[model samples]
Target: MSLEAPVVRGVELADDRTPRPVTASETVYEGLIWDVRRDTVDLGSGTVRRDFVEHTGAVAIVAVRDTPGVEGASQVALIRQYRHPIGATEWEIPAGLLDKEGEPPLAAAQRELAEEVDLTARTWNVLADFHPSPGAMSEAIRVYLARDLAEVAEADRHTREAEEAEMTAAWVDLDEAFAAVLAGRIGNATAVIGILAARGAKEAGWVTLRDPDAPWPAHPAHR
Candidate 1:
């Protein structure tokens, strides 16, 4: 199906489920990373106050390459980095926040690819986009498929520090990565979703893959 159909269909479906207007809202806390806000929603029959996190969305990349060893095998770039919230150095695809004002999602992906792994890709496509958690946060992540990779010069590499200082990058077989996701060894939301999505897309011959700069309505800043 054409990509526009999904967009239009979503809007049409939304017309029937539109929620009551927000009569009032206030920021309870403002921080460097995210903000907490209370929204007074009118539910027609009643009204309620709910607190949620206001966040800037993020992006991830599934950087893949063809390896000569196996007939149907492929390799993907993954990073092992410490996540403070989880208190673990989980394996994940290269990803970063979309915090820059007016920056296109594709550009943020490109910048993240170069900054995280010091690599660049000649080809890029939208692999998958999803909300990690919708109940309490307004964040989402768009994953991209990046191929034809090349390493950047040492002098131009992004310097690492803090949590990223101990990070390690590796090239793992795509099948192994997906297996890890199924086995629950890799718990990072983006990595698990992106790996499985990439496998499915590859099986389907990537026919449904969208352009790197595809429209993402879930990302409020992008719209």
Candidate 2:
């Protein structure tokens, strides 16, 4: 199972422009996002065969509404979208992949929350970074907890439906969201991870999410 190339860092070589041979029949089969390509790498005394994969970056975020519930539960905002890839309606926190040219993670998160959920967050804190599917996809999801949210003036209507496939905004509690995740209602990994992270951040008080100027416990806290 050990298929790593036995090459060292900064291998001594005279001709840097010299190209190595790529064996055509080294790998078994190829897979999307990555190929099972094998090649015999050159070493001092021997050549070893190996295979590896490449990746591109991605990002995700949990845009928490942070509203108090009627039943003493904490509420978190979410979105319902029809994911054509999975062919099932999915509920997830606001998230998207990084720009092809590579943009900042938090900036992308903020953009996504605004574009998808119609809310822009003022305070943002990075929660975690994870490789949602490292085996094949070049997807690296950056999770963030956005707070101090205010609704945007409007959203891009064109991408809201079919292109994005987002139906409507849905808000649920942390416990309920987690329960849905457990019961297979929340199927997106980004939302699950981001919600769990947001829950932790909320507990730690790093996210004073509600409007600071508003009267606490009666405005959005007690409602």
Candidate 3:
């Protein structure tokens, strides 16, 4: 059987979900946070088996504030934490998994910001959304741009433990963060995407941003 190429109609680029017939599926591994699954699928051409991680999705925040005395400049909040997989300390924005059942993405971002950095924001916008590695993982992340910042009250702060207890927070100029991303200093997927997307949004006068509670169809937990 010959497979015909799909027709293209417009210049606007977008991603669509393509569902294939899963002939067989099974949970290969179940961990504390995520699970691995192996599946046999029919891709029109033939049947193939693959293993992938099943994720609960997550949310990230690019908390921003205008630079004092620096016209048209902004600063972003960053956190440095030790990532065991990479065996190195990496810089990243405030983020957390969508493990809580029925909680919205905006609320998760808000909670992460306060928990990770002890900060809160009055304004929020959907900066960007993406799947870091679709081939091997079903993780989708939404990065939010948060402004009008204020510190969370000490009494209401979440207690940090494990790796989080050793995490450090800092405020860096957005431009500097962008430069760091370019220079290979900041390697976290969420941080790189958020910094670059935030810079682009800022250059466009933030007219491209969406509402904080905008529809996120890509996240399985939300959808």
Best by TM-score: 3
Q: Tens-digit lDDT track for model 2 on 115-172?
A: 7877777777667556676445434666666667888774442266565754688778
- Please give the lDDT score at residue 174 for candidate 2: 79
In order of appearance, the predictions have TM-scores of: 0.89, 0.64, 0.94
TM-score of 2: 0.64
At residue 63, candidate 1 shows an lDDT of: 96
Q: Encode model 1's per-residue lDDT on 3-79: one tens digit a residue.
A: 66644444434323345799999999998889999999998889999999998999999999987677777888999
Q: Return whichever of 2 and 3 wins on lDDT.
A: 3
Question: Candidate 1: where are CA atoms >4 Å away?
Answer: 1-20
Find the candidate with the highest lDDT and give its number: 3
- With candidate 1 superimposed using the best TM-score fit, by how many Å does residue 1's alpha carbon deviate from the native? 30
Cα misplacement distance, residue 170 of candidate 2 (Å)? 1.0
**Alpha-carbon runs more than 4 Å astray in model 2:** 1-55, 68-73, 100-102, 155-161, 207-223
Candidate 3 has a TM-score of 0.94
Q: Ten-residue segment with the worst summed lDDT in candidate 2?
A: 214-223
Q: Each candidate: what lDDT? A: 0.89, 0.63, 0.94
Error of 1 at 153 (Å): 1.7
Q: What is the lDDT ranking, best to worst? A: 3, 1, 2
